[model samples]
Target: MSTGITPSLFHILESKIGKRVLVVLDRSFGFEGVLATVSQNPPGIWLSDAEAVTLRSTLGNPYPQVTNRQDKSELFINLSHVLRVEILH
Candidate 1:
């Protein structure tokens, strides 16, 4: 992840409420899922249990293939399975 710029798509989700943006999650070694932002909760340090579950479901399934965007590559990981949340900016 890079510094001084937002990293987690969740944060981007929170920041861009009512706006549309691309969300990328790390599914595996290379696979990723791209989603269109539809809604978001207020800025917070953590996501609620319900939010986590909802995010997880959106991830669907992990893919063996990876995604390359903005010269970066990451897998699509389920947010519900995430252990920690970190901010880059």
Candidate 2:
């Protein structure tokens, strides 16, 4: 699996550290949190106070809802599993 750390993605992720973002995974799982770190050696994203959101599957469904409360303050997500990243204002 590709780490998904393209030059642009890396730059964008790096810049978003310490900021809020919505990370979308391959299976439509989402995480909304403050970006803690972006590792290049073993490409991954670390999120602080992250909330896992399960995306809606059927039409006319409600918006994604927070499904998992992260036990740890920091969450490390492998870049290979990241499908999309959206920086929040």
lDDT of all the models against the reference?
A: 0.31, 0.77
Number of backbone collisions per candidate, in order? 10, 0
Give the root-mean-square deviation of each candidate in angstroms.
13.3, 3.0
In candidate 2, what are the lDDT values of residues 1-89, reduced to their tens digit? 56555778778788878988888894557788899988886888899988877665546655454455444466898888777788888
lDDT per residue (tens digit) for residues 1-89 in model 1: 22232347556545644332233233322121223232223222222211111132234554222233222332233443443333222
Instruction: Report the number of the highest-lDDT candidate.
Output: 2
Residues forming the 10-long window of minimal summed lDDT in candidate 2? 63-72
Query: After superposition, which runs of candidate 1 have C-alpha atoms over 4 Å from their true positions?
Result: 1-12, 16-72
Clashing pairs in model 1, backbone N/Cα/C closer than 3 A: 25-75, 25-76, 26-75, 26-76, 26-77, 27-75, 27-76, 27-77, 30-66, 31-65
Estimated TM-score for each candidate: 0.23, 0.74
lDDT of 1: 0.31
Candidate that scores best on TM-score = 2
Candidate 2 stretches greater than 4 Å from native = 1-4, 57-72
